[model samples]
Target: MPLARTSDLLAAAVADRRGLPAFNVITLEHAEAIAAGAETADTPVILQISQNAVGFHGGRLLPLARACAEVAAAARVAVSLHLDHVEDADLLRAAPGAGFSSAMFDASHLPHDENVKATAEAAAWAHRHGLYLEAELGRVGGKDGEAPLSAHAPGARTDPAEAAGYVADTGVDALAVAVGSSHAMTTRTAALDHGLIGRLAAAVPVPLVLHGSSGVPDAELRGAVAAGMVKINIGTALNLAFTPAVRAHLAENPAVTDPRKYLDPARTAMAQTVAHLARVVAGGGQG
Candidate 1:
């Protein structure tokens, strides 16, 4: 299959009343692992490259984006390349040309009106280029104990009415709403408000996206999807699987210093994690 558009993936998931698991890709191995996992599960998945990941590669994005596109093209199941959490308008502008099928233009850190204006501009540009655009409405908890950007301090749940307004204002293809998940959480204990998810899904015109999904437990993830989340974004869980595999491989074979030796196992571990998450997103968790 060719690289599927992110809009198509989300649309399919919405039609099926299931969630699409979107894995964050940090390296070539990560992209490969995500593709392999989607193939193994016989399901479509989204390959997301974050701004942080781009920075980690020293601002080079095209190479990795092309690699992800190529991987998607060659995969048996559909795969889509998405630029995630992009704050720079320039980067967002460049994404469609650089082979990204979709982007999350994050202006959630800005004031509400500014976020709306910026996201609206991004949505216009994305639409012009035939790319899908996702925008965060309320702040899904950021890392490092940063307060969420809502009237409520800690438990900043997205208001259903506000979500509808935001979507109407910004015209985003998808809306990431803050329910209860926090980003970069290593523990899978985040309690999501499924009612809020349902409300947002009812009120918002676009598909509801669940960011910081790595912090959500498998059962809770299933519930979120059942409640109407179409796109589920995961990052930390892959890293959790990948880093430990590399460490274990290195510890076991101290004499071997080959990057491929350790990385291969790490990739496999992450692939397994992705497959499991994909299955969960596909409503297999209910079984």
Candidate 2:
């Protein structure tokens, strides 16, 4: 299949009451690896590129976006190409031109009305290009570099009432709510409020997205999905899986400095993580 729209992928996940796994793509390897994982799981998945990741590579979104689109197109299962946690309006606007099918315009650092107005502009731009837009409400605590951080607990929580208003104002296809999951947690111990998840899901008109999910344990991840988290965004877990493998490979073979050997194993490890999460989010355990 070709690249998928976020609304299409998320609607399927919501209708089936399953969580859609949206993994961050930091490199071509990451994109290919996640694609392989979805192929293994036989389910639809999303490949996301955060603004931080784009900055890491010197702001070349076009090359990576095209590569991710290729990986999604080649995957056996459906794949959606998404830009995640983008706070910069210019950067968010660039995604549709770069061939992204979906995006999250994150303006959570701004005050409520500004966040809504900024995100609405982004949503309108995306909608104009036939791209699906996801918006953030209430700052989710944590940092994927510049992602607005909150001092409050990861589960410090967003008011579902305010969340609904944000959605209505922005007309976003999906909403990422703050219900206590923080970003870049490698410990998998971050707490999530299932009650908040349910409340936000019922209150918002669009699908509910869970950011900072990499910190949430597998069991808790399952519970979050069951609680109405339709789109679960993960990045740290894949980084954890791949980084040590790459380091070990480089350490062992100092003489053999070809990038492929190390990169290949790291890619495989990330693919495995994706497969693991996909199965959980797809609600296929005990099968």
Q: lDDT (CA) for every model shown?
A: 0.87, 0.83
- Could you tell me every candidate's TM-score relative to the true structure? 0.94, 0.92
Q: lDDT for model 1, please.
A: 0.87
Q: Model 2, residue 235: displacement in angstroms?
A: 0.4
Candidate 1 TM-score versus the reference: 0.94
Candidate 1 per-residue lDDT over residues 175-270, each given as its tens digit? 888889878889998998999888888998899888888888999999999999899999999999999999999899999978999999999999
Model 2's C-alpha root-mean-square deviation from the true structure amounts to 3.8
Residue 217, model 2: lDDT of 82
